[model samples]
Structure formats: C-alpha cells, structure tokens
Target: MSAVPNQAGSWSTLETPLSEPIMETLGLLGFDAMTPVQAGAIPLFMKNKDVVVEAVTGSGKTLAFVIPIIEKLTRREDPLKKHEIGALIITPTRELAQQIHSVFSTFIDDHPKKDQLTLGLFIGGTTTLAQDITTFNQSCPRILIGTPGRLEELLTRSQKIVNTKELEVLVMDEADRLLDMGFSQQLSRIIAQLPKQRRTGLFSATMTDAISELVRAGLRNPVRIVVKVEDLTSKGSVQRTPASLDINYIVCDPEQKLIQLVRLLQAELNDMEGARKFIVYFATCACVDYFYKLLKQIGDLKPFSLHSLHGQMDTKRRTATYTNFTQLPPAVPAVLLCTDVASRGLDIPDVDYVIQIDPPQDPKAFTHRCGRAARAGRKGKATVFLIRGREETYIEFLKLRKIPLERGYYRLEDGSVCDNVLKNDDAEDEKITTSEVEDASVAPFIATLRAIVKKDRDMHDRGMKAFVSWARAYSKHEASFIFRLKDVDLGRVATGYGLLKVQKCPN
Candidate 1:
C-alpha cells in the first residue's frame, strides 16, 4: 500500500486516537500534522500489524514507529518492569541510533507517565559493555536503542538484565543499510531471541532483494508502505527525491574537482540569504580526513567552520561531530566533510546545500545523500561533481532509476578569476559553465595545494593515502562499467589531491 503524496493529516485523525500525552507532546514538538509516511503507517502499527516502510529520508520515518511504540506500551495491560524491554530499535549507525533516542526522549520527557517509561541507548563506542550492562540493570529502561553489534552482544550476553519476554515492538530503522553493512547475521541472532509474536517494522529509503529476504524472516505478513514523490513538472513521473530538493550536477576535469568544490562553497558563503550549513560527501574515510585537513588550511575557505566524520572515527568523536553540526547556528557558515556515515537517516536542520565530491559506491546512496537536504518539505539544493568523460555517464544511470538531474552552473561572482568569460550579461545569464570556472581556478589552487603539502609532512602523507583509497573505492563501484578504474587519469587525480607524485593504487 502507498501513502498519498500530499497527505498531511493531524495526529488525532488516526482510527485509534493516541493518548493525550502523545498528542500534547506532538503539539509541543511543533508537529501539528503527520507526513504521508507517518499518517499511513502509524494506524496500521497501532492496529498491531507488521509494516515494511519504504519512504525517502527526512520524511519523518522516526516518529511513525516511535509514536506506535510509545502508544502500544502505554496501552498495555501489564506494565513493563524495569528490566523488560517493550521496544527494540536497531539502526545501522550509532549516530542514527542516538538521533532516534533523542526523539523518544523529547516525547517521554513531556509525558505524564514519564517515570514509568524509560529509554536506554547502548551503542558501544563511547561506553564499555560493562557500563551498558550496569545502566540496563540500574535504570530498567523499557525501550532500547542501539547498533547491530552492540545490540546483539547485549541481547545474547545479558539475558537476565535485558528481558524481552514482554517485548511488543521490533523496529529496524534503515533496514537496507543494516543489510548493506553486513549485519544479516547479527539481525538473525537478535530476531531468534525476540518473541515471535511481536509487531515488526522494517523502515528504509529503498528496498532490495536482500531487504526482501530480511522482511520474510523478520517480519510477519507485512504491509508495505511506499511514499513516493510526485514530479510537479511531469504529471506521470515519480521521483525518488523530494520535489522540494533541487539536484544539479557539474562536470569538470579530474584535476579541477577540488577547486570547483571550493568555488561552490565560496558561492554559498557569499549568498547572504542562504543558510550557511553544508554537507560535503567524500568517497572514503581517508578522503574525509585529508580534505578536512586540507580545507582548514585554505585561505578562502577560512570563513566557514569545518568538521569531519566517517565510519572509522571512534564513537565519541562521531557523536560529538554530529551533535555540533546539527546544533550550528544559522548565522555561522559551516561545512561537514563526511563519508556515507552521515548520509542515511540524519536530519540536520537548515542544511542549505549538499555537495558531493564523489559519487557513492552504491547508486542507492545518491538518494540518501541528497535526502539530507530538502527535508520535511523544506527547500534545499544538492550538487554532485562528476568527471568529464565516462564518469559523466553516471547521470544516465541515475536517470534510469527515476532520479532526474539538471546541469549545474556556477555564478561568475563566486570568486572565479576567469577574465575571459563575459561579465556584463544579465543576472540569469551571468553564470559560467563548469569548464570556464575550472579553467580559471584550477592552476592557481593546485599550485597553492602542492606548496602547502610539500611543507607539511602530515599533509603529504594524508594526500597519498586519500588518493590510494579513492582509487580502490572507485574500482569497487557497483557500476564498474561506467566508473572503470582503467579510465581514470591518475596524474590529474593526484594533482587534484595536491600530491607530490602519482602513487600506485593497490589492487
């Protein structure tokens, strides 16, 4: 079953009304109406049905399951004991788990029965297993939220302290990512331990054959909820991304990628009316680390606050970075250089732009990466950087998947030094093509980067690592036919990375 694209029903409109506390909390949270996903799935969940929800990111998938979990627990005849878990929410990443926990806390903290219902977070990066066990025993949290590895360990090891005999709901948020991250074994083990009679909800942005297998095993005869985006311009076309999101792509030489990125950031920073928050995606963790350092040293980008996050970072640092970026003030211009770690289910407020320096290894991730912006019906823009030759064919690959793209243009006033381009045209026509902008900015920016890297040993080593890792990652892209490693211009790529020499990439 699919939700109507424009459905925005009130919380009270469900067949079974939610408790006063939930309704009151929803009002306080400024959620006066439910999005289509929430409106469609919440009623079924309330009626005790297994739901497989495939909706775009930032469509409020969190609260669809969250509200049902809270309502079902509150309506239970037998109150959950301190040690008994009423609901278990497993997501692929610690940052996403933390986000869900924060949402639950917002409601529970305002509820009248807040003392009776408690929430516990058990992702194991910052805290040890012993600490989690201690908290579980002492707090007797009724709801549990965590990553697969930590959840599997806690569920199997601490049976006495972690009771699920009364478990009512099992939600796998980002179910596709859970499978992508190779958590099938962990998910299987966790499912075997849970009560077979519980309500199961598997939420994801996209559905795959692997996810289908998981649904068969984990969920009962499930009701599939797909919330599709209607293309406003084309009557019969349905898009994977929100209509509010403006997705554009720029084609540049391999060597011009970095300077083009800097130019875009400069443009966003210069636009006084635009939100200063931006998310820039890199191909690998090494790239995030290298660029995070490289961008910090650039004189032009110094006005923006820079942060880095990747899957390889420790739990504490990743969580801290996510929190800091989400809480950044609208007045302060900031950019987050990250891997797909921040792409899936994060809802950073007022994100004006999402810049993709590298296309994701998985094509489906393109939707999620862009979904980070233009969320909750808000207007946002995303631009992906594609190299000029075979890599440019990726645009067609995405088009086949119902994701349309528009050619991106750069404003001449975006600090481009290209004097050859016309400067006296109308405002609409003053924009320059990617090549013109790249031609003007590439040589000087590359020289400056090389000089900076030559003087700093750490920067030199980081550039080499990032280049090697990026090449390997490209080789493994799902669309190998289009992103063939053999077609890459290694010398130009090295120049883009500010490397002293082109290094050999590992097979």
Candidate 2:
C-alpha cells in the first residue's frame, strides 16, 4: 500500500517535493505518513540546511536523516562517472552501524539504478584490516556507514583508496552516546578529514552539554528539532509515541521491588487477557542477572521463559540470546532482561509490555525503553517501578521533562491491587512465599526451547553441539530436565532431526 498523506506536512504530503524515485522507494517501504521528527527535519534538509534532531528511539529518527542523505547523494551531476563517497554516517556501535547500513541498503535495493550505487559498513570485531582495505580499494561505496574508531583508522591507513574530499553529507547518529563513550577526540579527528562545505546532521536521544558543543562545532546554522512526549497526547496528532501505548507507573518499597515485579509477572502470565511478550529494564547487569535467576527459580512463573542482554556477557551468548528472545512466539511467554544497551536502535517486534524496574536516570532513557514496545502503531503497555520514597523525585523529574505518565495499580502485600503506596510502605515486614503457587503446563515452555534451537538451525548450519551449547547457556534448568523426553530419547530425537550429533555433550 502506497502512503498517501491525508494532510499537509506528512510524508505523502511531501511527495510532490521529493523526487519520484524517492517517493516510490518510500511507498515500497510502507512509510505512508511522516513521523514528527521526519516531517520537522526533512524539509529543512531538502533545502541543504543543517539539522540537529533530538528524538527518542523508534520515532522515525533514522529516516528523518536517511531520506535526506539519499536524496542528496542520488542528485549527483554525473551518475555515469565513478561514484564517490557522497555521504558519511558515523555511529557509536557496530550493531547500530550495521542496522543503519541495512536501512540504507533496503532503499538502494529498490532503486532503479542500484548497480551504480553501493553502501559500505566499516566496524570492528567482525573483519580484519586487510579485508577492509581490499573492499575499500575495489569499491569505495558511494554511501559509508561506520563506527568512529574504525572510520578514523580506515581514513588514516587507506587514505588513497577512501576519498572524502567530495563528500556531500555527514551524519552523526547517537551523538550523545558517542560523546559519553569518550569518542570526542576520535570524532573530531574524523571530522577534520572531511570536506568543510557540506550539509551535516547530528541526531541523538538526548541533548547534553557535550552534544551542544558538538552541534556548535559540527552543524552550520542548524535547525534543532525536538519531538516531545506531550505531543503524543495531542488529539489527532501524528507526532511522538503512538497513542495505542498505555504509559503508566507503579510505586513500591525498595525492599519489595523484587516481589512486586514477581507479582506483576505472575498476574500478566496467568491472566487470560494480558501480554505474553515482555521486556524488563534494570539499572545494572547484576540486577538483571539476579532477577533472571530469581524468576527461573520461581515455579509459578515457569510459563514465562527468560533471556538477557548486558555488556558483561560474551558476544556470542549475547547475540544468541537476542536472536532467541526476538524470534520466540508471542503466544509463548518470554521476558528479556536487559540494560541501556538494549534500549536503543534495537527493534524487537511484538513486545506486549515494557517494564522498568527502576526509574530511568533520565527521560530520554525512559522514552527509549518504552519505544521497545508499541511499535509500528501496535498497542502495548509500559510501566515504571519507583521506590516509595523517591516517587516524588521521579514524578517531579517527569513533570519537568514534560513526559506524560499515568499512575497504575498493582497487587500489593495487603492482597489489594491499588494505585497508592505510602512513602514508607515497608514499615512492616511481609515475606512473599511461592509454596502454594500452582504449576503451569510445561508444553509451551518445552516448545519454546525447541523453537529457539530450530531458529538457530535455520539461521546457521551448525550441528548438535552448537544447539546443546546454546541451550545450556540459555536455560537455567539442569541439563537433564531441559532435554528430557517421555517417549523418545531427547538426544536421539535431536540427532535424527539434524540438530544434534552423537558427541558427548558438556555437563
């Protein structure tokens, strides 16, 4: 379905101003209406103006900058001649770089003259320097997406092969993160190598002092665009978070947080009409790991499987867990415990609920966590858990940030699900016990485990050893219980199905 805007300042509304080819590509991408950030920034960009956009994740910020770059790069005077690197997109992480490159590749794939254009991804941890140099020498892509460190290295080592003198556009995605990660000097060095006269864009979830400095030095008379949360509350507005999402908060005692989370998960898991897929956020990896273990030990919560994403885990384990949780069916309950790393630029579909165990350090982080759900206009729920005493502080912060949050009630120790919690709710001791908790059927749980291994097989041609390794690493159950079967030997069945080999597995 081609997007036809109903009013002015919409994507379909901008159709006449954009070239036919770009509009055709957008139609294929299913982008009918323009996101607020996109509508606010794209017109200025089309006129060769610099822009600094501060929009939360999943607010179409990517396309807000990407479309303009595409338009500028494709409008070259001589397409028949060897294409030069027209646009340079600098990202903070390898995953983000790959994601941005994938977005660019999608449009390029649909272009009429795709053979004349190329998109390159330069990031560390996957390829060697020699391989990168060879690719650069053979095909200096017309559009380049890469991390700051690797891009700087390539510019210094392969100076002759990689040219930026004619670079028409430059973009810094997640500029705040880059600055927070101490990439100021490296970003500066890379910028020093770029052409002085070019349209620039700086996009991030937040605007800190460091980001402001970057904007001052980087963009020229840039137009600043901020997509506020209150905009979503406006009637008939097409800006900010989708109206389908239910944004709420829950206040509890610090000591009772874990029990409160358990109760919420129990209610959601047992309720006939509740979301099955959930993403729970925490302040630290230790908290995530601790809570993941606690949930695994709770028999009542057995219906819901758990996955994790944090900086401490090995890259292989982290990637595997991400793939599993993302692929798991919504009917089979799954919860992904993660930190800020999973909050940005990572799109996980069908997320029914997003729970923040603690109030996020800032409003931008809260918005990104909520963005994990209610995507693509789908209805979802987001809840924040605040300690009793700090409720007022967080509430004040939200008010100052102009974030719209509704109070939500949850089942408390008093056996009543209510919205109000006193500042010192834990004055009396109440221990939560699971002794009487009933067991949910294991059919769905077992099937979810098998489904993960099956998806891994579909993605890679690995043998049984790999499956066992992943299962062992991912599941908290003892190896025997996780792989046990009533009729057929689980090992034999797996081997017969090409998911396992006859080698002795690790304990």
Please provide TM-scores, in order, for all candidate models, with all chains considered together.
0.94, 0.74
- Candidate 1 global CA lDDT score: 0.87
User: Which candidate wins on lDDT?
Assistant: 1
Instruction: Indicate the TM-score of model 2.
Output: 0.74
Task: Please report, in order, the local distance difference test score of every candidate based on alpha carbons.
Answer: 0.87, 0.68
Residue 270 lDDT, candidate 1, scale 0-100? 71
- Candidate 2, residues 191-303, lDDT tens digits: the string is 88888889998888788999989888887888887765445456543334545678887755443455567678888777788889999987666556645654565566787
lDDT by residue for model 1 (1-507), tens: 655547678877788999998888888878899999998889899889999999888899999999999889888888887678899999998888888999999999878777667999988888888889998888888999999999999988875578888999999999999999999999999999899999999999999999999998988899999999988889989999998999988877778888778878887777777658899999999999999998899998999999999999987788789889888897899999999999998878888899999999999999999999988888999999887667777887899998989877543434654323234553342222223343655678899999999999999998999999999999999999988888878898999999879898866
Candidate with the greatest TM-score versus the true structure? 1
Which pairs in model 2 have colliding backbones?
Answer: 3-32, 464-500
Per-residue lDDT of 64 in model 2? 79
